[model samples]
Every structure is written in structure tokens, then in C-alpha cells.
Target: MDPSSVIWIFFVFLFFYPQVLFRYRLLQRYKFIKQFEAVRKTRAIVMIHRQEQLALFGIPLYKYITIEDSEEILRAIRMTPEDMPIDLILHTPGGLVLASEQIAIALKEHKAKTTVIIPHYAMSGGSLIALAADEIIIDKNAVMGPVDPQIGQYPAASIINAINTKYTDELDDETLILGDIARKAIVQVKEFVYDILKDKMGEEKAKYLSETLSTGKWTHDYPLTINKLKDLGIEVNTELPNIVYELFDLYRQPVNQRPSVQYVPVPYKRGTKK
Candidate 1:
């Protein structure tokens, strides 16, 4: 072939290869999910967000739970039979309160058993949705964070603290306003958390969990380990299904993206050094 023809063919392969691979992966994921549903006899739903570059712009975008996510999840829940169980695989850093609450409330109202499996971490709003589940299945190393409300970039509790620590006259008008809104946000989220947990556990335990998770005692990104959760009477199961890890593998990081962490893909025995 002429050099010009060869160059054209290479460009075509580069452009078409990714598209073909993406479609194949999508189909494979669908098949795997269907098989999982069949084995578990439940409706399988996944809410995962990864930092990926846009196709046209190639600019990396961070993802969080959005209203669109809630809409789709709610629709899936509605389509499921009332008697069918739901398996929600959540991997998120968290998102909009309204969106998260919408999803949590719908899951709470589901007639069948609801299970949330966290293969890695489900922080903030993600943790809120987990509270509504009948069971939380998480990897032993996985973490969940406080559901404390964040006013803009600041934590609600911190905003309130700033106002209280300094006199009203010392604070800026906007700071004072944020403080007031922060207090209200805390109460609203605490109540919502209680509502989701009340029926699952008794009212007392529910209240405790609600306050602990939503009152902003810890930083927004504070990691709540399985042990800590269990200590708080969360009854979290650490026996995460192998298929869940497999499913997560399908939602891999974008191609051509560099990974910061790398290690041999094998389990190492204790006291064995590489």
C-alpha cells in the first residue's frame, strides 16, 4: 500500500477501535448483569461515577450523583415488580441533596428487600441511600462517610460553628446567612436520616444513627469503616459477593488515562515480600 493509504488506515483503526471496544464492553456488562439478576432473583441497579474525559472535548469531568441519576434509578425501581428484591451497587463520592433524598426515599418505600453493596466507598449522599436499605453489603476495606450537609464548599456544622464562635457583629452578612441556613440544613438531613432508619431498627437506634451521621461531628470525607459501622449497630455485612467486584471491573477508568496507583494483580500472603 502507498504511504498515504497506510496513514489513512491507521487513523481509521485508531478512531474505530475505541468505539467498537466500548460497544462490546457495554453489551458484555448487560449480559453479566442479567446473569447476576437471574442468580440472585432480584433487580440489579448500579450507580457508579468515574472521572472520565468527554469524547469530543477530551476534558476530564468529575461525576457525582445528579438529578438524572435519581430519575433513572427511580424509574428502574418503579419498573421492578413489588415482590422482587433490589440490589443497588453504589460507588460514588456523593451528590446533590435533593437528588440523593429522592433516591433514598424511593428505596425506603420499596416493598421488597433492598440491599446496597459498596465495593469501595460510598460517601455523603451515597451513605444516606445505604441507610434506607434493608442490608448494607460492603467490602471490609470499604468506607462510607458522614451524610452531613455541606453549604456550598463548607460543611454546615462548620458554618454554624463559625457564627457561634464569633459574635454576630464580627461576622459578615453572607456568613451569618449561611450559618442560619446551615442549622436548618442539619436538622432537615438528620430528620431524613431518622425516617429511613426508624423502621429498620427501632426508633432509639435510628435516632442515634441519624444524629451521628448527619450532625457533622466528623469531617465530610471522614471514613466510616465496616468495624466502626458495626460498632454503631449498623449490622453491615462484609461478605461482598465476588460478582460485585467483577461488575466494578467493567466500569473501569477511561482508556489512555494514567492511573496513580499500580500493583501486581494478585493476592499476597502475609509475611511474603515481593
Candidate 2:
């Protein structure tokens, strides 16, 4: 071939190579987005606190529920039609009290039935959210936990009890103030729990369960098994649906891997740069 013809061919390859690569990346992203939308359309809302999804600099994110998370959940609820049933998949160590309450209330107020599926554990605030569900489905090995409120890192009940035991001279202003706040928090949390349970269980039964869960009788992190929950008048299903396990499988992470950034290319418009 002529040298000029060879040079023209090379220029064309250089011009089109990046465009080809960009299109391939765009196609992959489009496929992933479609799959995600399909899953959302299934009416399953998952709140799994997986280490991979929540880790930052080796620290676990969402050790407590956040206000931002409540907003995201609200958005998801908005996307769901009022007549559609909601299936909530919960696996978390729990988080902020107010944040949890927001999500719990939203779930409770949903027009259609809401079912909570616990494949493993839903502790603390997670338990609070579970209480709002119309039905709870759990595996035999799954656990729910006490709904006692925690102020900062200290359990509210413990803080109040400590104040009662300690002499006035031994307690500083900060300690006294915290104890007062904890006392009020304990009452507030019990009220919230009662409200969450009142519609499913009667008011009296809800009150009893709320008192039992919030007074720290079994400790804050006490794991309530299926039998215990049944005794408490909660309708607990020992058999978890296959879809719950499949969801967990999708979110599972490999052991010993650090969190990393992920990038997906956006499809370019026809008139956009290569």
C-alpha cells in the first residue's frame, strides 16, 4: 500500500479507538442499571449493614442509623406505589434512635402490608424497625434484640441506675445532667416502641412488650430468639423465604478485602466528545 494511504488508515484507528472503548463501558453500566431497577421493582427493600457496603477506612459505617438514611428510605417508599406490598430485608446492628424511629414510622404508615425478613440478626434500632412491620419472618438462627435506648455509647437504663446508686456528693453536674437526659430518653423510647406495636398487638400488650424491651431487663444487646419473640406475642415465622437468602447472597463480601472505589462510565450523547 502507498505510505499516504497507510498514514490515513492509522489516523482513523486513533480517532475511533477511544470511542469504541467508551461504548463498551457504557453498555456494561446500562446492563447493571437495568438489573438493579428490576430488583427494585420486585418491591423488596433491603437494609443490610454489610461490612463491604458500609465500611470506610476500615471503620464500619452505619453503626447507627442516620437521618440521611431515613431520607433515602423515604425516597424508596415514594417510588413504591401505595397499593404494592413491601418486603423489608433487615440485617443490622442498629443505630440512632430518632433515625430508626423515622424509618419505623414510615414503614408502619405504608398503605399496604409490610413484612420484615430477618435472615440473621436485627438488633437495637433494627429491632425497633422490625416491630413496625405487619409480619416478621426469620430463619431459625435469626435473632432480634432488646430495643433499649442508648445515649451516646451508654445504655440509658444503666446510666439512670448508676445515678440512683451513687451518692449525690460523688456525682458531678455532667453526670447528673446525663442521668436526667437518660431518664427522659428511656421513657421516650418506650413510648415509641409502644406506638410501633400498638396496631399489630393491642395497646396493653404493646405497653408490656415495650416496657420489657426498653427497661434493659435482659441487657441492651440481648438476642431474642424466635421462641422468645413468639412468647412476647409477636408473630414470628421460623422459615425465611428463598428470596431473602438470595438477597443476602447478592450483598455478601469476600473476607479480608478493603473497600475500594468503583466507577461506571456514562453513555455519551452523539454530539458529545469521544
Candidate 3:
């Protein structure tokens, strides 16, 4: 072959390889989702996010639940039959309160049973959505987090408390304004949480949970373990299906940087040697 032709062929291969690989992975995900739906007889919706490298720039971009996510999820729920169950595969570090609440409310209003499956942690708004589920299936070691409202870079409860401690004359106008907004935000979120949980658990237990989770009892990022959640009277089960773990494998994070953790990717039986 001529030198020019060889170079052109190599460039064409490089250009098409990543696109082909990405399409193949997407197909694999859809296949597994269909399999899971067939086995469980439910509409399976995935809301997972990972830090992915952008094409060309290779810049890592983190994803969170957004308005767009809510729109799509809501549509998926609507398309499901009234009696069909819904299985939401959730994995996120939380996101916008409006988007999360929208999704949570939609799930809560669904006529059929709604299940939230957390293979890992679902913090902030993610936890809010999980609370709306009729059943929560999580990995034993996975976690949920507080739903305390945050205002800008500060916690809403903290802002209100801090303002209350200070003399009116000593606080700036912006501080006073922020405090007012913070109080409203906290009240709004607490009420929303209570509304979602009241029917699932009793009103009294729901009130306690709403207060504990939304009133800044802990930091927004605090991990609520399976035991802690159970202790708090939230009945979350640790019966994550094997297919969920397998599906998570397909949503791998971008490999633009050195991976922090490594392991032998195989199962071991105690009695049988490899």
C-alpha cells in the first residue's frame, strides 16, 4: 500500500474506534435493563451519574440530577401502566431541590409500587427522592444522606441560627435577607419531607424523620448507614439484586486520571482455591 493510503486508513480507524466502543456499551446497558425489567416485571429507570471526560477537551465533568433528568424520569413514569411497578436505580451525590422534589412527588403519586435501588450512596436531593419510594433496596454498605437545605454555600438552618444569635443592628442587610430566605427554605423542605413520609410510615415517625433529616441535625454530607436509617425508623432493606451490581459495572467513571482503588475482579469461594 502507498504511504498516504496507510496514514489515511490509520486516521479513519482512530476516528471511529471510540464511537463504536461507546455505542456498544450503550447497547449493553439497554440489554441488561431489558433483562432486569423482564425478570422483575417492572419499568426500570436508571438515574446514575459519574465523572466523565468530555470529548476532545478530555475535561472531567461531574453529573447530578437536573431538571432534564426529572423531565425524562417523569415521562418514563407516565408511560408505565397504572398497575405496573417501577424500579428506580438511583446513584447520585444529590442535586437541585426542585428537580429532586419533582421526581419524588411523581414517584409518590404513582398508583403502583415504587422501589428505589441504591447500589451506593444517594445524598441530599437523592435521599429526598429515595424517601418517596414505597420500598428502598440498598447495598448493605451503601448510604443515604441528610436532606438539609443549603443556601448558597451555607446551610439554611445554620444561616437562620447564626442570624438569630446576632443583634439586628450588628448584622448586615444581606445577612438579614439570607436568614429570612433560609428560614423559609428549611420550612419548605421539612414540610415536603413530612408529606412524602407520612403515608409510608406513621405521621409521628414521619415528623421525626423530617425534622432530623431537614433541620440540620447533621451535616448535609453525613452518611446515614443502613443501620442508622433503620434506627431512624426508615425501613430500608439490604436486598440489592445481583443484576443491579452488574448494571453498575457498565457505568464506570472516566479513566483520564489514575484510579485510586484497585481490586482483583473475581468472586472467591472460601472452600475452593482459584
Candidate 4:
């Protein structure tokens, strides 16, 4: 190896070896094990940051809801030694509904109260999990989405292109394939929308919400804001979840900043009247 390359490697190992060990958690394994035992003994709130894990073409796939580097969490969940009050802090754009539902059922079955704290956003399938929680705490501006499952083709621009092709240039047999695909895409979108109807708001409303969101009913829009969750009876408030307490209060915090608490009509206190 070149002498410069060898020297660089030595400096890298010296400077970054500790960080590598920490990231992999090799250095603190024993200490963490002991602390894990202690935390399990007390009724401490369990904090899990389920950020993006799965994506498709830059879009968050619902299936990424699975826990990664979550053996500690899995162990904690399985530790039935004592009852520990838990709070799940979720900030997701929504992925797979079932993955979220499992976490919801697990939290609800174990603790006395499983409050889902939406520090920033809990949308799509994430919203479904929030619905399962006993209490949902979110800032007034904190968003939760339409629960109206989106089932549609992306870039509806493709459909537009196909139409233009047929009109502008003489479309051949492949155009026939596009015709069939576009038709089926519409039907697939409808079927998915219909299925979601059966799950939420009963058959009638699910059907309506699905159809409404899919078609031009509500106007095809993305990035629906926090205001809509307010309309859905979710108590949007400025209350802080327990995780935020530790983030600002404790030393060596991981997250950059606490979510901005937005004031809304919903009451943050336990007994306050709406």
C-alpha cells in the first residue's frame, strides 16, 4: 500500500473507531443491558422513533413500518416482567397499515394507557395507528392526514401523455395496451378505495370517502395539511408529549428539536372541557 494511504488509514481508525463502535452499539452493550433491565423495572415511557425505512422511487412505502435495529424494542415489548406505561412517538407519512396496526395492538394490549404522541406528523396508515391509541397528543399545526387511503396512478401525467399520443400521433397496438392498462388502473384504484371503505366509517362512509378522495371529488391534492385532522374530530392541541420533555430537559439529546406546539381549540389538559 502507498505510505500516504497507510497513514490515512491509521488516522481514520484512531479518529473514527469510537464512533463506529458507538453507532453499532458495540462499546455500550453491557451498560445498555444493565440499564435496560432497570428501565423495565420502572414504569418508564418507551420511546421509539419510527422514521423512514422503506421507500419506492423516493416515496415512503407503507411496508417500511417494520422496526429496524429494533431488537431492544422487541425485547422490551416481550418483557412481561412488569407493567410499563408506554407512549409511542410517531412522525411518519404513513406506510403499511397492517404493520402500524400490529404496533398499535401490541401497545394497547400491554400497558394501561398507550398514548400516541404525534410530535410532527402521523398520516395515512400512521393515522390508523393513532386512532387505535387511547389519547392522541398533537400540536395545533401537527398534521394527521385524510385516512382516506390513496389508490391511484402517479404523475397522472402518464394518462395525459397516453391521451395525447392517441390524438396527436397515430397510436399503434402498444397504445392498445396503454388503453387497457389505464382502464385497469382506474378499476384497481376503485377496488382499493372500496376496501378501505369497509374498514373505516362503515360500508357507506368508507365507500364515500374512498371514492371522494380518489376521483375529483375533493380535488386531487397531495400534502394535505393538519387542518383536515381537526375536521376529523382529532383533538389538535399544543400539549407536549413525554418524549419532548426528555429531548429538551435531558442532556445528550438525540433529536435536533422538539416539534413546534401549535395552539388549537382542543384541550391539552386531561379534565379540561372542550
The best candidate in terms of lDDT: 3
TM-score for each candidate, following the candidate numbering = 0.89, 0.75, 0.88, 0.49
Give per-residue CA lDDT, model 4, range 37-116, as digits (tens): 24433222333333332223444322234443133333445543234444455566665434554555565555455566
Segments in model 2 whose C-alpha atoms lie over 4 Å from true places = 1-42, 52-63, 254-274
lDDT of 2 by residue, 1-274 (tens): 9999999999999878657765554454345433433553435566667554333356553334667667767666666667666677778888888888988998999887788779999999889989998888899988999988888888999998889998989999999999999989989999999988887788999999999999888888888998898888888887675655654664454333211111122322223221
Instruction: Decide which is better by TM-score, 3 or 4.
Output: 3
Clashing pairs in 3: none
Q: How does model 4 fare in lDDT?
A: 0.47
Model 2 vs. true fold: TM:
0.75
Model 3 per-residue lDDT at 127:
98
- Which pairs of residues collide in candidate 1? none
After TM-score superposition, what is the CA distance of residue 8 in candidate 1 from its true location, in Å? 2.1
- Name the lDDT value of residue 228 in candidate 4: 62
Model 3: worst 10 consecutive residues (lDDT sum): 258-267
Candidate 2, overall lDDT? 0.74
Report how far residue 17 has shifted in candidate 2, in Å: 20
Would you give me the overall lDDT of model 3? 0.85
